[model samples]
Target: MDTMRDRFAPVVSRILDEDPRVAVVLAEIGLVPFLEAQRRHPDRVINVGIREQLLVGAGAGLALAGMRPVLHTFASFLVERPFEQVKLDFGHQGLGGVLVSAGASYDVSGGGFTHMAPGDVALLDTLDGWSVQVPGHPDEAEVLLRQAIGAGDERVYVRLSVQANREALPVDGQHLLTVREGRRGVVVAVGPLLDQVLAATEGLDVSVLYATTVRPFDAAGLRRAVGASAADVVLVEPYLAGTSTGAANDALADVPHRVLGLGVGRRELRRYGSVDEHVAAHGLDAASLRERISGFLDVGVPGVPA
Candidate 1:
């Protein structure tokens, strides 16, 4: 019911008002809102300039000194650049801090390839005690952000999409928003694309499941839900499907899991282009996703060996 800015503004305002030890760190473009919030309450914010490495490193240092730090940065800069600091300083030392990575995936359309961090989801998993989340919408982002701040963990990355397009889904971690009662197969959507999958279920008896949490999935709950469905399970993610947690759903459940890997194909980091074109080229667009679903449905499951 609340707007994205509305959801974030109040919490940030409250934190600034009460938590004197709470400091906000912004990296480059992520500084847009941090600066605005700082203007509103100039005394409380801490701008880390464009040094993303130092930005994370500083957050680690601040947390080590018993201060609460909320660090904001683009997904690529926040995850890829200061990875050593994040792993060694935070994960190893067990520092307490929140790293809010904004504009994940195609959200960085205008920012080009250099600004977009495709490897973050895969990279974050390498750390031992990190909590990684990718919220489909702004409202979900708000809830996850609140959770991350209060988690009191060494590291947490709330991967956020740029556009606030879809309305917030009832995040009960149930059915991922029921699409349609179908006999064919269940389409599991990872993020914002749940809307498109729902739309594609017009004539088909399709069910859509939104797997919101990447790392800590509710396996027992998911198994119960998918077990109730007659169709096979198809897991879809915004990025490459198999390499990330999207693929792990197969191992987590007994259902016949079909992982749909989306996003750009891995290659030499030679090409240069904005994020939108890159995603589109990789078949991450709405039409491409729909086509993939249709193909999956048409192909059906191959006869399994007895």
Candidate 2:
């Protein structure tokens, strides 16, 4: 299966060919894949060397000039390194652009902490009027990319990752899709973590909701999922833990609800390891998640007591 980054290149290339207003700005991180697109649309596809700030500034400038800019780079460089430019050039200036980031969380675990961006989503949450999409599969990535490009002057962020599920879920860029139903609680799985979340909650009496677009928080869908009963929500994101717990609380502010936000922890792991190792260390793998989820929900495991 093609990784999300692999699918991104061809989709953006086709968009550049078909849409004249679309422009892609790179910072020499993922340049190889966009080489052909650059050759065809020299002015539209730009490379700003390793200058991460300039990459965002240039993209914001293009947006200011009535062009739709798609900024590409690793998550750390795209959002963390050039965050000031992102805030002022785009948010403060009220410009609209698409910020597409590769290397989600520990996708590039071998590259060490410099390449990991476990707080990318949480950092972006500080800004207003930005739509964030975390696609679990390449096909879903293509859909969300098209929607972001055609958003017409709306600020958008598309997070691409090497991790993916076995199949694509029908994500419409808005609202959550119900994958399983139960009366006890609801488990909200974000992006690539859906498969692991499903396996963790196997046979557990809880509903599972799949989320691709998380910026808006899908408050209404979450409320509907919990229904009129006192709610218990476990948000399984691929980013910083408790990143969206506040949002979840706000969504159910009027009702009685308890939320458990699980994801990449804040502690820095100095040793570089494989992605699976990173997942295990963060307690995001199936086995760890099963224990955590059951403990939080007060639901007994098949062979264990609550």
Candidate 3:
């Protein structure tokens, strides 16, 4: 039976096949798939040794030279180690390419702290031309990948779970996916986590916005989504709380809103597990989301009918 990871591998592989100018700079853990693609299409893959900093720097250099580079690595190593390189070389120059950070947010089991930290989008939130995208599922991931590739100027960060996630109906990076109609409150889910928002709204009426792109956020779409609904707005993300989601939410603060951000608290290197396990441990499950949004609505608009 095909699993979630199975669904994702092919899409990236497809990109590899179609773009002769593209080379995948992948980590040891990320090697197998790209290697397989190369086996099928010899002379396509570029294996940059496991050095995270070198991987990111080389990717930026490749983009500068007009070749598309897909830099793949574990999330922690990708964002944390060579952040300066990404910020200075990629973001500063407004280079285009996909930074595929696998094991995004503890998705890989036993991958260790070196592998897991729910990526904090804040790291790139301030870089001038960098945009962050966390896809909700297979369809979203594919669409976002194409959009990022086409988005030539900005440094696009495509973050996804190492495994396949429940696929939501396809949504454009430009269109916000609505989870509910009559809004009692708006919960803007970050990525594949849209499933949790859907579950949270089972018996209640609330608005849900699925953000495919955190930076270069679909502002017009968001303004319209929130404007149509009379409710408080909250942003949810896998990053450190009060960082990317909060910053993103604050950018829209003029909309008469109250915002709440979600993420794994900051720490050295502690827990190790799959993304699902980490989410459950951090109270990020469907029930938790439902309860939290409900509470936010209650506090924001007293006596609002469910």
Candidate 4:
């Protein structure tokens, strides 16, 4: 199966080769994919040793120097560790570029909590006007990447995770896609969780909206889906447990609505295991998702109708 990471190298290479104005900033991790690009374009493909802060700083510098820089590394190192640089260098300085992050949440399960970054998307939320994309498949990732690159002078964050759907899918636009329609409620499936969401909602009477570009939140589309219903939204993100909860609330704030935020749970699972094991532990498997969705829809949780 071709994971999102597998699709990254070629996209970056294409951008680097085709767009002379583009550059690739890398830390020590995840550099194997872009080795050929580095060999070819030594000036553009820069690996600043093991310095995460420098990675962002160099990218910011590159951006300031009239080059669109694409920073790459594991999610934890790329975002969490060098956040200060990302904030001041990119946000404060008003510089725009692309940040390609790998190993979302517990992707490197055996690498332990130090390597986990479930809160990456949530962190990006703190910034102002960042284009965030969580692609569910390799095809979607490539399309979104091309779009993001095409989106010049805008700060974009392309989240690359291990989890992916069966086939590569395309987005109609930059907004939420209505995969399936229903009247009861709406299930917002963010990125790779589409297949799982589909499997979970097989016989249910709920609308399913897939989101690749989640930063803008696509509130108008969400309202349309809710129609005359209670505006019950279930956000199934591949990142932190309730990363997109605020987005959901903001989207449905105008109407009477309730939300059940689900993803990798908040509680830290200290045990070490495989990625699949970690996923199940967080109640992200198909069975757990189905049960939760059914429960949220069937029962009257804390508020709303029974």
On TM-score, the leading prediction is 2
- By the TM-score metric, which is better: model 1 or model 4? 4
Clashes of each: 3, 0, 5, 0
Candidate 4 stretches greater than 4 Å from native: 299-306
Task: Judge candidate 3 at residue 269 and give its lDDT.
Answer: 37
Model 2 ranges with Cα > 4 A deviation: 301-306
**Ranking according to lDDT, highest score first:** 2, 4, 3, 1
Q: Which of the two candidates, 2 or 4, achieves a greater lDDT against the reference?
A: 2
Top lDDT: which candidate number? Answer: 2
Cα TM-score of candidate 2: 0.98
Residue-by-residue lDDT tens digits, candidate 3, 123-226: 66766766777776766677777777666555778887744447656766665677676556667777766777667666666667777777777766666777
Error of 3 at 105 (Å): 1.4
**TM-score per candidate, chains pooled:** 0.80, 0.98, 0.86, 0.95
Off by over 4 Å in 3: 1-9, 39-43, 162-165, 228-231, 244-251, 267-274, 299-306
Flag the better candidate by TM-score, 2 or 4: 2
| lDDT, residue 299, model 2 | 82
Between candidates 1 and 2, name the one with more favorable TM-score: 2
In candidate 1, what are the lDDT values of residues 85-158, reduced to their tens digit?
88887888878788877657646556566776767877887777666666677777777777677665546777
- Worst-scoring 10-residue span by lDDT in model 4: 297-306
What are the clashing pairs of model 4?
none
Per-residue lDDT of 71-133 in model 4, one digit per residue for the tens? Answer: 989999988999999999999999998999988888898899989999898988899979899
